[model samples]
Target: MSININSKLDSQNSFWDINLEGELDVSTADKLKEYLHGLVEQEVVDMKINLSSLEYIDSTGLGVMIGVLKKLRTNDKEIYIINPKSNVKKIFTITGLDKIFKVEG
Candidate 1:
C-alpha cells in the first residue's frame, strides 16, 4: 500500500502536525523524505507525526525516519511520533528506537 502524508504547519510552535496513513515502505520512503524536507526548507523544524492510521512500516521506512531525525537534530529540532498501532509499536520496541525517539500515545 502507498503512504499518505497530510500535514499543516503550526506557526505558533514553528512545527507541523503530520498525519500518516497506509503503508510506509521502500516504495514510499521518498514521500516521507520529500514531505519532511520540504517542511524543513520552509523553516518548519519540529513535527508531530501522527501514525495512528498507519497500517505498516518497513525497515526502509524506519530508516528514513531516523535519517530525518538526525538531520533535524543538526538544526536543534525534533520529531515526535504519535499514536502508533500495536504492531508498529512492536517494531519500534524491537529496534530499540522507542528509547531514542519521542513517542506519545
Candidate 2:
C-alpha cells in the first residue's frame, strides 16, 4: 500500500509531530522529504516522528530520514522517532541509524 504521512506542529515545543503509515517505498519517500523540507524552512527546533502505525520502510525511506537528520543537525535541531515497528527498527539497527538518531519508547 502507498504511504500516508501526516504532521502536526507543537506550538509549545516548536516541534513537528509526524505520523507515518503504510509502506515507505521509493514512490512515497518524496512526500516525506517534502514535509521535512517545509519544517526546515520554518526553522523548527525539534521533531517527533511517530512510527507506530508505519507498516514497512525500504532503503529509500531510510535515505530520506538520514538526509533529514543531516539537515536538522546543521540547524542545531533535534529529531526523535517514537515507537518504531520491529521490522523498521531492524533496518535502522542494521544501518547504525539507531545510534545516530534518538529512538524513543
Candidate 3:
C-alpha cells in the first residue's frame, strides 16, 4: 500500500544508491516517479536501485521505471536494478524488460 524509498548520492555525485521497500503499484507509482525525476533534474549520472525489500510491482510501476530510463538515457545515464525479489524479477523477465534494464542478482 505504501512504498518507502531510501536514497543516497555518492560523494562525487556520479551515482545514486536507492532502496525500495514495499509494493510498487498504481497507488505508489507516482511517488517513485517524482523522486527519480527530481534526481534526474539534478543531473544525476546514474542510479543503482536495490529492490531486495520490495514486495511487489505492477505495470504502472514498470512504466515509471521505463520513463525514468528514457529520461536518463537522454543524458547517457543509466539505471541498474539490483537484488529484485523473485516475483519482481519475473515481471521484468516476462515483460522482456530484463534486457532493457540492467538487472543484477
- Number of the top TM-score candidate: 3
Q: Mind giving the per-residue lDDT tens digits that candidate 1 earns over 40-69? A: 788747989999999998899999889889
Stretches > 4 Å off in candidate 1: none
Off by over 4 Å in 2: none
lDDT of 3 at 10: 85
89: Cα error in model 2, Å: 0.8
> What are the TM-scores, per candidate, against the unseen true structure?
0.95, 0.93, 0.96
What root-mean-square deviation over C-alphas does model 3 reach? 1.0
Evaluate model 1: give its lDDT.
0.89
Q: Rank the candidates by lDDT, best first.
A: 3, 1, 2
True-structure lDDT of candidate 3: 0.94
The candidate 3 region of ten consecutive residues with least summed lDDT is 38-47
- Each candidate's lDDT (Cα)? 0.89, 0.87, 0.94
In terms of TM-score, how similar is model 3 to the real structure?
A: 0.96
Evaluate candidate 2 by giving its C-alpha RMSD to the native, one decimal.
1.1
